[model samples]
Each structure stands twice: as structure tokens, then as C-alpha cells.
Target chain A: MPLPTLAESAIIVGAEADDWRAAVRLAGRALFESGATLPGYSDEMIRMIDEHGPYVVIAPGLALAHARPGPDVLADGLAVVTLATPVVFGHPHNDPVSVVLGLAIKSAETHLETVAELANVFNDSSAISRLTTAASVAEIQEILGNAS
Target chain B: MKIVAICGSGIGSSGILKVNAERVLKRLELEADVTAAHLSSLSSDAADAQVILTSAEFVDAIGPTNADVIVIENYFDTEELARKLEAALG
Candidate 1:
């Protein structure tokens, strides 16, 4: 299966959040508002980071936050939150993350394609730049489309 | 040589590491196969690999193996990954 396009409702541009947790919560709220996942899904993401580390800061200025699939996820979903101000994840190499992509997948078996696609998107320097300053959901979607 | 990039889940950060690893190998003109795996699923069988790259948090989980486990603090820094890979594979 190919990676699904991020839903417009799940994209939050210029989100205001003082820290990484609040930024994650804002992204989680988008997923929740879209009925993609249950409440507290964002908290679960934070829990994973707290327990382990900032491994989710996959790239410089980018974080792909997620947790295991369970009751928290109603369906496979993705959310993009571009912060007005960057927040630090305390990752040695990748700090001050400005883009947080929230993922809520139904299962591990079904997430390979989406994850692969996301990796491809994040790997592109130009795409990352566009996403960092994307003014609207449409612009973000266009960037994803171009990358795909 | 075979290299595997491990993360909490095979699909996420590991994927990023794998791509960066591939780029590093290509730039160095080194011919090797690189793959990604979940930290929980990695085992002694991975001893066949030349190197195993992952975050520092997972080093203990990887345990003892014939393969050299390189703890990468950042998965996205291809330059750092290349530097480390050269030092190891050379």
C-alpha cells in the first residue's frame, strides 16, 4: 500500500507552542479532531520519548512523533504541525525541531509504506525547507505531492 | 558487507538511518548492502552484519554480537554517519 496523503484537517500551520510537548499536543489535537485517534494519544507519544529518548527527532529540525498502535488509534492517520517557533527535543544532533509530524497507525504491518514515504519526504532538503515555511495546508500538501 | 539500522520500530527512524547509510556508502564508493530492523527483533543472527547502527538508547538492547554496534546520536546527520562509517569500515 502507498502512503496516504495527509488530510487537510490534520495540518496545522504556524502553530503556537512554547515547547515540544505542547507542539506534540497540538499535532495530536489535529488527529483527534479528525477522528483518527482516541484521546491521550499525544500523551502516549510523550511517554515514549520520556521513557526512551529523543530518537523521534529523526532529522535536524524535524520530529516524527508516534507510539505503538493500540486503542489510542482509531485508524491510520498523519498530522503535520509547523511551529511558529522551534522547540528543542534535546537530541544531540537534531535539536530545535520546527516540524513535528504526528503518526497514528492501526498496526505495524500496515505502516511500512507510510513510513517509507515519510522517510523519502524528509530526506529531501528542498521539501523540508518548503514544509518548514509552508503558510497553509494546501502548500504543505503540494510539497508532499511534489516529493511523492 | 551488510549493515542494519535499528530503531524502536523498523519503519520509522530506522528508515531514515538506512537511507543516510546508503548515501554514505555510495559517496565513499563502498559496495555493501544496508537494511533496517526493529530494535526488539534484532538478535545474534545480526552478527552476520559488518556493522549495526542505531541510537545510544538501544545499545544495551542490541547486546553482545560479532557485529560492531555504532551508537549514533543523530539519525539525520549523514555527514556524521559517513565519518563514523568510514572510520569503522575502512
Candidate 2:
């Protein structure tokens, strides 16, 4: 199945965050604003990073923030936040993530499928840069395979 | 062969790892059943797997396993995954 449809409201462009925690929190806030997760879900995402190190920096300049399937997830949704200034997450290879994706998954299977789908988009290194430099929400939506 | 991609929750980064591994494996002209799983289910999910793919952060947490646990540097970098996977299973 296709990844959760990202709403326009959930997209934040040219967002400013002081650090990785704030950057991730912004993505979680987008998820919350999009009606995909509860307000506390952002903290859970932060907690995961605090516990596990910066493995969430899956690729150069990219970070996908999320937690396990939990009650906080109201729906399977994805949020995108482009940082105006990148922040380091202490990753050895991939550091200073500018793109933070907050994902709220209601189930393990479907969310995994979405990841596969998302990989197709993120696999292109240019697309990742575009996301970081995107000035408009529509550009991000387009880059992420969302027309709207 | 069986491969497992593991993460804290198994849904986010691990899922990305699983997909990237499948792509690399296909490019390498190799076939393996790859699954994404959480750290909690490592024992059962990766029991029979020949290789386990994950980031360095989880290496200690993975503990001891018969399978070779490969610490992936970048989940989206096919170059890194291809090099490591080819070196491991070439």
C-alpha cells in the first residue's frame, strides 16, 4: 500500500530548530497537527533518540523520527519538516540532518510498507537535497510523491 | 538466505534498512528473505537469518548471534550496503 497520505497542513517549510531534539520535536508537532498522533507522541519520539543514540539519521542530511506502535498513534501518518539550519545528531557518517520526518504508525506491517515506499523517494540523493532546500510546501510534497 | 533489519521500534529506520538491503541483494544477483524487526524481537525474528543489518548504535544490544551482524553506516546508501553485503556474502 502507498504511504500515509501527507496532508498540506502537516508540511512545514523553512522551519527553524535549535538542535536535533527541537528539529525532531517539530516533525512530531507536524504529525500532531496532521491528526496522525497525540501531542505526547513527539516526546516519545524524542525519548527513543535519547535512548538509542542518533541512528535515526538514516542517510546524509536526513532523519526519520518515530517510535514503536503505540496508543499515541491515532492514524498512520507522515510529517515533513525542513530545517532552515541543519543540526548534528552525533551520527558518525550521516550527520547534521536537515530533513526530519515524523512517522506515526498504527500497525507494524503497513508502516514497514510505507518505509519501503519512502525508500524509493529517499533513495535519490538529489531529492534529499531538494527537500532540505525546498522553500515551499508544495515542493516538498512533490518531492515526497505527494502532488498536493 | 534470511536477512533481518532491526531498529528500536522496527517500523521506521529498520523498515528503510530492509528495503535497501533487498535492493542491494537484488543488484548483487543474490536472493534473501529480508524482514524488519524491533530490537525486542531480535531473538525470534533473526534466529535463522544468515545476516543481520542494522546501525552501529545497536551492535552491543544485538548481543551474540550465529548470524553475522553488519553495522550499516547509511541505510539509504546502496554503495555502503552493497560493499558490505558483497564482502560478507560474496
Candidate 3:
């Protein structure tokens, strides 16, 4: 199945998250509320960051918060939260992320497929800035073209 | 040569890095096998790889590796990938 779009993926715009963990939690909240994942998924996402450093901060202003495939992930889905105030993940360069994208995949195979498809959305250098300022889920969908 | 893209979890944007690396390699007129892998399994997944592409934050975690570890700041930036790949493997 294709990844959920902004409508079903629980895209939260201009959300309030004071810290990186809170930011990931906001995204995870979206995923949970969307019926895409279990409640403990957010804590897992945070733990990944804690154990592996802030490597999830994939881009200058983006954080692809995720954990390995597990029972916590109800389905292959995604969630996004735009922080009202950007949070830092302690990465030297990609710190102060504005967008926290929660990704839950059932398997590594589909995981690859999802990211390959998402490559188009992220390829646009301005995607981060646009997503950061998008007013609503519709605007987010617009910014993230080829939304499924 | 084989290249492995490392991320916190293999089942995430490492796929993006893997695909984008293929695109960059093709544009540079180079060739290699690329795979997405989790950082924790660096020993097995990257055992026979010649190059390892990953984010800066994961570099130190990689510890010691025979392969050339390249830091990619932006997995979506093909231009940066092209430049870095050219500089390293040109």
C-alpha cells in the first residue's frame, strides 16, 4: 500500500513542540491518532534518537523520526508535524528541525519503496521550508506532490 | 564496488539514500551495487562494501570500517551527492 497522504497521515501544521522529543511525539501523536500505529511507537522513536544520536535529522530542517518495524506499527504509514518553534536534536549541522516526519513501515522492503517514492517530495530543496510554512493538511499535500 | 547506505534503521530514508546514490552514480558514469542497511549491523550488511554513505551523525557510530565512509548532509541533494561522489570515487 502507498503511504498515507496528509489527510489520512495526520499532518499537523503549526504545532507546538518545545523540544525535539516533543516534536517527535507530536508526529507520533498524529500517527497514533490516524490509526496507523500503537501508543508506544512515539517512545520507541525517541529511544532510537537517544541511542543512535540525532542521525534521524536527515536534512537541515527535517527529522524522519522512526523505529524498526515492530508490533507498534499498525501499518505502513507516515505522519508529519510542523513545529511552531523548531527544536534541536543536537546534531552539529542538521540541528533545529522544523519538520518531524514519523514513518512506520511493516518491512524493510516496503520501507525502501516508501522512501523511494518520497524522494520526489524531498528532492525539492524548498520542500522543508514549504512544509514548515504550510498552513494546513491540504497545503502540505500540495507541497508534497504525488501524495498517495 | 558495493555501497551501503546506513541510517538509524535500515527501514527508513536509507532507501532514499540508496536510490539517490544510484542516480548520482549513473550521472557520474560510475557503477556499483547499493543497499540500505541499519547502522547497528554495519559488520554484516557492509562487510563486503567498498563505500558507505551515511549522515554525519552516524559517522562515529560506524567505528572502524575498511570501506570509505562518505557523509551525505542531504540525501535528496543529487548535486551534493554528485560532487561528493566525484571527489571521492571520480
lDDT of each: 0.80, 0.89, 0.85
- Candidate 1 interface RMS: 2.5
Q: How would you encode candidate 2's per-residue C-alpha lDDT over B40-77 as one tens digit per residue? A: 89999998999999989999999999998999877778
Using all chains and alpha carbons, the TM-scores for the candidates as numbered come to 0.82, 0.96, 0.95
Tell me the spans in candidate 3 whose CA falls farther than 4 Å from its real position.
Answer: A146-148
Which candidate, 1 or 3, has the higher lDDT? 3
Give, for candidate 1 chain A, the lowest lDDT window spanning 10 residues.
Answer: A119-128
For model 2, the superposed segments whose C-alpha errors exceed 4 Å read none
List model 1 lDDT by residue over A70-109, tens digit each. Answer: 8999988888899989999888877888999888878776
lDDT of 2 by residue, A43-101 (tens): 99999999988989888888889998899999999999998888999999898888999
Q: Which ten residues in a row have the lowest lDDT in candidate 2 chain A?
A: A108-117
Where's the lowest-lDDT run of ten residues in candidate 3 chain A?
A1-10
Docking class of 3: medium
Q: Give me the displacement of residue B74 in model 2, in angstroms.
A: 1.7
